[model samples]
Target: MSRAEVKQLIGVKDVARIVLGWGAFAALLILHPLLEPPVPAPVLVIALAVIVAVILVCAFGVVTQAEALAHRLGDPYGSLVLTLSIVLIEVILISAVMLGPGEHATIARDSVMAVAMIILNLVIGLALLLGGMRHRGMAHNRTGTSAYLSMLVVLVALAFGLPALIGVDGSYATAQEIPIIILTLVLYAFFLFRQMGAQAGDFTEVDTRSPQRSPREERTGIRQVLAAHRAEVIVRLALLVVTVIPIVLLSHDMAALLDDGLGRLGAPVALAGVLIAGIVFLPESITAVRAALGGEVQRVVNLCHGALVSTVGLTIPAVLVIGIATGQTVVLAESPANLLMLGVTLLLSVTTFAAKRVTAMHGAAHLVTFAIYVVVLFS
Candidate 1:
């Protein structure tokens, strides 16, 4: 395709990824000589980190563009796009590692657990704690919160809990997984229908107290704003896909580097999972935190719980299919220790949200659970 034709397809936001993709390519050229040499641990770490930083920049661009689109699209759809973009990143990252030569049977499981831990315990906790400190207790819809919590609890139990209680084929059975995968997708679709379709005015509703638009935005007019959002969505969506291809392409190298690096350091084998989890979770972490601080705990819940549900709801099916097609083993259960923490964290989260208001102390409790997760990760 001619640059002119391609140029017509992209907007200002797409320029960010275009510029970054080129910069990353140039950086790789510069690093060719360095990467060719016998790579040292520190040197390899630096090299990998640089590459990761570039990928992260692309991801952040996607998040920014998606955030704008969310503002324009409105909740349910907007929130769906926001969380799905982050979820897509997580999926891409994990799929890359899983499909690589690394023998990480549990990467999918660990990554899901990590995302849930980070969002529920860390992000949710911080949002509530900080917001509560300022507002004491912000009123939310108890029934709505409870509905989301109910689905989440059932899904988590089915995905993580039942997997632990049952095993087959020396690992997670393809037969078993395929049904769960289908059920997961079907159930999640039904949940979305309930949330966005039937129950739109109830639990899944957006905050009526939406912040006012800027004077500039007000003058832009609905048609103009939608046109801009549409253009941006098209351009950035393409760019986001283009940007992620490289991240996936480079996953083999990243997998090798991480495997060797972590192995050499005598670190926990799970550190590789943590690295991917941390990288993928970075954008949502910022958004979730911001939602909390803005007295938008519902937004925070939507982002956090939406992420958690998407992780288990969507990722399991995708990962299972990949694992089965590639003839690779897949593991889905957490350690007993992690399972305990996850159960308690889920329990605490639902309990806290049962009230029409959440307090800072509730946030602190979740953070404590997060701390415990970290300690378990290393120990």
Candidate 2:
């Protein structure tokens, strides 16, 4: 009814993202026949560029809406919403590729590994580096960070490491996959229970020495905020879902183009995974870095570590189930180089978070490790 209300409901940029994202999806559907293979190289390049651009726009739109909801929801819950929204897009993209007409047995594995490396090392590294430089040192909830890392260690080992050791090839047997799907889901469910219930405080920023709000008071405050912005929250939530649909619909087209383009270019196969990971997480990475710079170190941890946890906990099972249903052979094992990188990353993360305060020096270590990952990727 008022100017402020109108502005809060939706902005010009939000409308632009929705229109462009859907417009691109519509164009792809109509021009599908013409865009099919044996197409001209120039056309393929142009199509890929346009589609990727639109997807990026939609991704940022998702971030915008997620952040709005997050502000209303508060920490942990807010971060969870943002993390899950991004991961949903990721899972959709991976599933689209796996279901497409190709032997993409390892797309899941590649994408998951890429996500881990990018989020854990590259994004977190930059966040801490910038935050530390600006603030000298940043404080975060050690218990929360430790919980995330511990769960990550177990999930990463189960998803990427153990398969290589035990499977005849590079994946679990059909029998093994069944139980794994259940176990992974169960563990993640338990984690959700603790994270949202009894242990929720661990995931939030709190001054331990200072007095704190009672949980009931905190809940009441959050409720008041949400109630006041109910209309805005609903609008943003709807827009977030609307924006994500186009990305999901366009993923098949993108995957086909990507596979063909890479084959022609002779680029490394792993690069496809890297690109997908980058696209899905790029917005969140920016958000995390901003949080770090603002000295919201715990929020940064929630965005980065929380994201990877969901990526592994949810994605592995989704792909495994997809593999089982489609009769596709899904490979989950990492090469020796990647396995070593994972081990080092987990160890380094533990050491970094164990400290009382995170400093620029810790960030440097992470960046160096990420550099090695880049080298290994290209080499």
- On TM-score, the candidate that comes out on top is 2
Count of residue pairs whose backbone atoms collide, per candidate: 0, 0
Question: Could you give candidate 2's per-residue lDDT for residues 1-379 as a string of tens digits?
Answer: 4669867678899899999988998889899899777668999889988888898888778877777777778788788877887688778777877888979888788888998999889999999999999999988889989999989999999999989988858989999999999999999999988887667778888577876666666667667867787776667777887887777567545766777788788887777767766766776887788888988889989999999999899899999999999999999999999999999999999999999899988999999999999889878
Model 1: lowest-lDDT 10 consecutive positions: 214-223
Give the Cα lDDT of each candidate. 0.71, 0.85
Best by lDDT: 2
lDDT of 1 by residue, 29-75 (tens): 67667775446878987878877877677666656655665567655
TM-scores, all candidates, are 0.79, 0.89
TM-score of 2: 0.89
The residue ranges of model 1 lying beyond 4 angstroms of the native Cα positions read 1-14, 25-38, 48-60, 96-102, 203-261
